[model samples]
Target chain A: MIDNLLFLAAPITVSIILAGILSYLGNHILTRGIIFVDIAVAQIAALGTMIGLLLGFAEESANVKMISYIFTIAVISIFALTKFKKQVISQEAIIGIIYCLALGTAMLLAERIPGGSNFISKTITGNLLWVTWKSVLSCLIMFILIGIIHVIFRRHFIKISDSKNGLPYSLWKTRAYELLFYITFSMVIVKAVPIGGVFFVFTLLIAPAAAATLFTDSWKKRLIWSWIIGITGAIAGMYLSFTMNISNAPAIVTLLGLIVFLFAFIKLATKRIVSHNLSKEKGS
Target chain B: MTGLEFMFAPLVASLLLIFITVYFGIHVIEREIIFIDIALAQIAALGSAVSLVIKNISGEAAGHDHDSRTLLAYLFCVGAAFLFTILKNKKIRIPLEAVIGIAYAVATTSAVIILDKGAGSDVHIHDMLTGSILWVTWPQIIRLSVVVVLTGGFHYIFRERFRKVTLSYHGVDTGLKNPKLWDFIFYMTFGIVIVEAVNIGGILTIFAFLIIPSSISALFAKRWTTRILIGFLVGGISTLLGLYLSWNMDIPCSPAIILFLGAGLLVAVGLRAINKLFSHQRQSR
Candidate 1:
């Protein structure tokens, strides 16, 4: 039993590290008002995996990973260029539509190709328990590299995320900043998506950051709290799933969901209590 | 009656969806929740997947049909709408799209997990996404027709109220009495329509059906009546051509039909571009 429990250590830890990385991306996503880009990028990466399978590449091969990153970065570049523009159809609508298109096209290709169905399930609901140390080691290396790059050019990302849409295209600085942000973010997504899948990645990315916003006005403090929430939620979810025979992905997702709701409730209740006390004092 | 028996049922089913989706699509577009159909549809499908896992674990054979699944789906979809309506109370708390994206993430992940636990989950999910509308039964068709007609009647009667609620109160401080109730009604009717739709069609085809027709029409049509007419016209043309091509090429029905709609949209865009150039030339002359 102890060994069985200990075996879950690596996967859980990797998920925590993943949470730390993606929570920052989640912050940018929330700030940008484009929350669904992760899903779209995740789907496009899955499409890359499908394309790899079509080309006879091994399921977890370097070639497959390379193709996935290439596809994701290209898609992200397109988004960086044009998606922020004002359209008769809104930006969120376009993101949502692109999401469906990616999903449909991926499903069609998976059905038509052999050995593709396996990739489909892996893409949608990844096997978090089955992650090997070799894969985890590679993830650690990639995560460290991406983290260093992000820290080095963190200010550029800040400038890009803080910039409002509808800026003139002639300002190459703004355009370059936006492209830099997307490229780095895509790297983060391509690394995390294979193990955790879209939902796991997205929940880690958004929920902690969203919950943190209620507590802190400072981005620095929020970043710290986001990591704390994500790490705690992931470990607790793993424990509960192990004890209760629940699936891990859903377990983490549901717990994070509950965490967000709990934070919101607390925020609401505190405001009410304060207002109620103030009114009582005035009446007296 | 002829060798085209398989195509006939799917054709009838697609026609019914085209009728209602063209109407609902406008509201979805106006509300800027273009993926609401897919979101609600997935929520409904998630409900059924949960029940299936429950039954399988308990080793009991409960009846699996439209009624049980639709009930669970409405419970979920409406609950979701309630949460979303509150989250989107327009006080600048959290953006509506963020809330929606979060809900969508959690719902879909829970669904995938449940489906993974239950046997034949892949088949179940595939059926939900790319439904075998080509092989729909008579009883299913009759049931769907009844639901759609009843829904159409309700929509026709309270059309103005829906228009008022969606258009007037879009992200504004409405402060009405129980606007959640109004949002509940919208999601409920939409749930009823799309649950019936998921019964015959799947998420992929139904999503395409809702958006593509109305979107193409939105490009050109001005009045509501003209838009709906153009929607029907395009839907009919696409269905005919898609089915014909599917029959000839032996591809899957729904994806082929989706491709046809996409093709149709591109053609519409191409024609509009040509028209724009010609108009510019005429103005110059």
Candidate 2:
């Protein structure tokens, strides 16, 4: 029983940490009008894994898998850079291209390589029940490190994110601000890749951040709310997955979606109720 | 024949198809209905799966062949596209996204089941995902070219009406109110996108060709005509480079092409940042 608990503990911790980091990065993405970049990046990561499998890399080679993800990030970053001029093209189109290209590449590669079908299938439709200890530990350490860094550099991060407001008069300057933004984004892609396997990462990252935005105007409050919602969704999803005997990633995504929906509904209801009360009071 | 002839044929054909897809994709992106392409592609894929099952059950040897199967798949895709459009108008009030998502999910699962049943080879399914541009036949090329020309012609004729309809939603009301025309244009675009998409590979190819190059071009070009021209250039370059890289390195073409586009975006961003920096430096100086 303890062994089973220990086994489950790693995945749960990783999921929560991932949820937190993704939520933070997702907010920045939304503000930049490049929200769909997450989806594109994640899908590209999956495609990379598919390519790894196609290239005769064993499923056990986590390092090779990581390499593929990096490749994906590189690809997505390049596409993002080139399409910087067109207002009409939009971020969503770039994301659409990423999705298509990744999936298509994975399919083509799978057809050629041995054991490619199995690799392709598993990568595309991930199974969370097979979470290993190594992945969990790496995720936990990365998450903690990121969390500490975020705490230390919170002000700087916020300033860069709101660069449109101009540089803040702080101990640090413009170069520092730019460095922090790039690092944070890179960390987000790296950490998110392993946890959600592309598709779920975007939802985990974006949904909580988006939900938090609806409730808070302050950056600090929004970040805190986003983290809280993300952790809550992760825990709930894991528990649900454990009880339901389903895949963990999908379960977490579904939970996050539900939470977003619920928040939206409650927000709508509260606004209506408050307005109704104000009108009644005025009438009296 | 010659290596150049063999190479240029597929490249030219793909370029024509990519052009058509990009134009329609731009409109789709502007409307914020990107998922419609994905959903329709999945529906078409589902139609292919159903066709495969029917052929298997009928024990039809000819129908099971590659050429025949592809033809059948195309027919089914066209049929599904029409059916989907009709269903959208039936007052069921189903959100287009939801319908497309559900259909895609169902189709994917069905494909899995059909493959498991040993009805069709896995290679066939893979073909549906990543198209082989090197193998595009002459007839297919002609078909795609005709579709591109027709779609472009239609867009040109209705350019004023389209601009009016799109802009009129902003409350200035461009007096070009014709609900039927809107429906006709959208359906035509959707139909052409779906058909051309299946011919290329599936929704992914259609989507990449449709949206990526144009979106990237938008970053550099200000004018609409210039944007389109640049987009076509980007698309054409990516296709050629992607094919070359894939052939040389023995990697998948689609991702390579996408990665190439991504590199372009990064370069653009870098240039913009440099421009800003230079302007700032000049002001200080």
Candidate 3:
């Protein structure tokens, strides 16, 4: 039992860290009008997977190696688009388009490849039970790299997120913030793609961060709470799925929903209780 | 008659559905309820999934087997749509997006589990995702055409009233004052859009035929007539192009159509920017 728990440490730790990064990124992206970027990136990554399957890169082939390359390219494309000022379309609209196109391409490609239909299905839905030791290691390494970059560029990120107020400051450090933001977002897409597939990654990237924003005003607190909720949700979800023999991705999403629901309820109840207590105090 | 012959009904049904959806989507855009479409789409998806589960429990195959099951699915969808509209009108404290997302997630999961256990491998969930537009027949198409015509006629008859309600803040007050008239128009439009969208995979249809084109047209055209005409042109061209692309490339039609619209928006933006740049440079010179 102890050995089993130890074996699970890597996924748990990686999930916690990845969740934090995703949540932070999601919140900032939502505010920036690029809320659909997460979904688009995930879909693009899945498209890449379909391309891999078509090119005979099955479980045994070099297809797995290409996941990172495809993910990186997709992330860079999105980052570059978001950086443009005279964008004719909203980022959300562009992202939505990219998502559909990528998924369509994947479907078309899957129809051509032998036994590719199964791969397409798995890519969309995902199978957490099949996660290998290699996947776990990859996730950990990516998580550490992202966490380090985030720490190193925390000040710059904060400035960018506060661009409205940091207009003067940004004039001096303009490229720095953009570069950091792009790199962090790229890392997020890369790490999230393989682990959760598209759907779970999209949800994890946005929902927890959005939930955390409701409870805290400060970026620091928001990031902290977002990370806590994300990790707890992942671990709890995985455990429940394991016991219940259900798919981990959907279970994790359901867990996130439950967490958000609980938080909202608690906040509402607390407000009511506080008002009641204040009224009684005044009466006394 | 071959399997191809059988596909005619769905194909025609989907085309009619597309027309009605595009018309309603114009209103959805004008009202700035873009996210509301997403919410309704998710609700419809959930409703369909639940209906599928119900059908499976009764020992029926998931698709195209029984007309009654399909009817049940539409009923469920309309019911869900009504509930969503009511909740939205009431201004419930819950964030509509969250509620819709959760409902969508639950519905999708339930649908998958039920289908997986019941039908095994022959049934594809992608059928639900992509829709069966290829299978629509002539009679089905005719039925859809009638709905579109009637709905369009009704909108024309009440055009001024709707414009007032939509364009003015006072419209809501007027609506409250004459509840029955406004309610009738509102429900008619709502029910028509829901029915048509259900025929075309809900949000995909609305997004492609209505929201994207209307938004793009609104960006360039100041007058409502120009906006509507431009929207119709963009939508019709994109739909034709999307269908052709899907047929040739063996891709899904709906997403292809949306991508075309997105590309159109990009081109429009590019043109506006170039025009602005040239004017600025000319002025400077």
Report model 3's TM-score to 2 decimal places: 0.75
Per-residue error (Å), model 3, residue B165: 9.3
Candidates' chain A TM-scores: 0.89, 0.76, 0.75
Top candidate on DockQ is: 1
Candidate DockQ scores, in order = 0.37, 0.15, 0.20
For model 1, residues A1-284, the per-residue Cα lDDT tens digits are: 88986899778878877887888777777766677777677778888878877788887799987888888788777666654343444555556556666666676787767755555555556668888888788887887887887788777776666655555444566667778777878787777776776678888988888888777757788789888999899999889888987788778987897678667767777777998999999999
Off by over 4 Å in 3: A1-14, A51-64, A67-79, A82-88, A116-120, A158-183, A242-245, A261-284, B1-18, B23-42, B52-103, B110-125, B146-195, B201-206, B222-224, B242-263
Between candidates 2 and 3, name the one with more favorable DockQ.
3
On TM-score, the stronger of 1 and 3 is 1
Find the candidate with the highest lDDT and give its number: 1
For candidate 1, list the clashing residue pairs, or say none. Answer: none
lDDT of 3 by residue, A93-201 (tens): 5455455556555655666877665654554454344566777677767767877877887776766655532242434355556656765676667556656655567
The digit string of per-residue lDDT tens for model 3 on B173-202 reads: 543345435544564456556655545553
lDDT of 1 by residue, B1-285 (tens): 474886788788888888988888777766766666666776777787776776778887766555666577778877777776655543335555666656766677677556656222353244477777778887888888888899889988977677666765455555555666777788778877877787678877877888777777877875777888898888888887877777787766777777778777778868877997999999999
Give the CAPRI class of candidate 3: incorrect
As for lDDT, the candidate ahead, 1 or 3, is 1
If you assessed candidate 2 against the hidden native complex, which CAPRI class would it receive? incorrect
In order of DockQ, best first, we have: 1, 3, 2
B-chain TM-score, candidate 3: 0.69
Looking at model 3, residue B11 earns an lDDT score of: 47
What TM-score against the true fold does each predicted structure earn?
0.85, 0.63, 0.75
